[model samples]
Target: MATTTTTRSFLQAVATEEVATPLRVVQMEGLVILKIIKHCKDHSPSLVTGQLLGLDVGSVLEVTNCFPFPMREDDEEIEADGANYQLEMMRCLREVNVDNNTVGWYQSTLLGSYQTVELIETFMNYQENIRRCVCIIYDPSRADQGVLALKALKLSDSFMELYRSNNFTGEKLREKNLSWVDIFEEIPIKVSNSALISAFMTELEPDTPVTQCDYDRLQLSTSSLMERNMEFLIECMDDLSLEQQKFQFHYRSLSRQQAQQQAWLQKRRAENMSRRAAGEEPLPEEDPANPIFKPLPEPSRLESFLITNQISNYCNQINGVAGQSFNRLYLMKALHEE
Candidate 1:
């Protein structure tokens, strides 16, 4: 009976197709945001991840609770160990009488370098299990720059279909009309604070003396972020160039081998025909131990695509930061003249 029930659940999961839902709006509780911010800040410089627990309504996923995962080896070999640890944590959460069901997961990213295969694979797994689950990316580095960068994202329907097919060929992409923009659907996040908490915060607001803040927004510290982004973008370009060279070399080698194989087959056929014409038994046909050529294995292009996407993201971020910095500089100049 247990096996039957398991089979039925599996069938139900497979049969349910995720429709193109309306734009998701994430309603995150104030406490949930605080916990995530604290978790990310505490684990700065190293990527941190946690699970979000909440209820999902038709258009909004209300996140109420979260807990950070235990630190684990980042190597792929210990993935199973991490999974087991998460399961144990989930069991404990169930005992605590809190919302333990995983509505989604959250990860900290530096300068938005979150578009990797691991993230996509994790999201796929989570969405497969819970269709409405979203991944929240917290940019701690950006947050330190006086902006709380929290974005809730989900793999778009077309992107999920393309990924599940595992066919990223040019033709397939064209058929699906997929692009980098289609990869992630960002949901607007609204922080919901209780009245009591709001009152408490308001009561504490007057504890500090009010003073005029001069040039707070005009700080040029954004230059450092812009520099780091440029450096990373350059490195990615170098890696992309190397990947392109590798693909070119592979294709050239493959073409040469194919040509040699064709020539060798033709020569053998000619020899066989000549021998038969001479009224002699054709030489026993057998493939040569060392064939004329062997094709090189095709290299995986997934990493190349991911790197390209990351570079694009960096460019977008740089543009935004630069624009804001320019506006600040203009304002500062105007204020000084005044």
Candidate 2:
């Protein structure tokens, strides 16, 4: 088995090296692509959680920080599984055909509500040209999302780093000049999970123009109307989360986590260094035997950024795909009011 594995690895490397860059590049001409990310934070202090959306070439993505975790265990586990699966999807996109045509949407179902999976499936079937392109769930026929079905796709370590560029940060909203409605007509919203679709349709009443319904009647618990759906959603989330933590404990890295710890140590060192420069004594080192310095229940560093810049960019990206241009920050502000 070891010999065969080595042979396969060698062949893959050789194949990659032999293929010319131009030839290897996937030809994505008329294809519309959507990009999703797990951001750390958002513009608002109270908002948290990352987003999933389509990319806009002419403008940036509009992201927000409202990552609601799954209330149910099963739902949480699946989302955790989806998060890991996303790493591979990121890699797969690098070589595939890419174009200026992009759309952005956020995953707002909260974690674990396998209902979001239904959203994705719906989008896939909504239009002939549209593809869900999720990072997880390799086999459509499988009963459960398998871990091994994940395929490795290479991505640049610097991809997310590009958000820091002046263009991404400094650009102002081009408001009056932007037109978004033209692009909205192109998308086909497919429905795969009928239960979710029916539920949403029943709740969604026709209001204004013949356009799509953007607002959801999130009828709070005073009425039984929303109770059944809400309870189911939360339960799915909790289950999903537990499974995710289990997978992380079993398959995730010790070294990588340790390195995160090391980075924290370095940050503390810097804080101490500055204090010492100002004439204060630094604190004592953490005892190696103590478990106090260990990883905690806190969110990862990625979450911190997702809540802010990442969230804003994600939101704006959707506008670009919709053919409307707007300020990234303003989009989030507008989205919040609704």
User: lDDT of all predictions, in order shown?
Assistant: 0.82, 0.34
TM-score for all models, in order of appearance: 0.77, 0.19
On TM-score, the candidate that comes out on top is 1
Per-residue lDDT tens digits for candidate 2, residues 108-173, read 222122223234233443323422222211111110111111111111213212322212221121
Candidate 2 — which residues are off by over 4 angstroms?
1-287, 291-298, 304-310, 313-338
**Clash totals in order:** 0, 58
For candidate 1, the C-alpha RMSD (Å) to the true structure equals 6.6
Output the lDDT of residue 261, model 1. Answer: 78
> Model 2 residue 181 lDDT?
20
The weakest ten consecutive residues by lDDT in model 2 span 138-147
Residue pairs of candidate 1 with colliding backbone atoms: none
Error of 2 at 107 (Å): 13
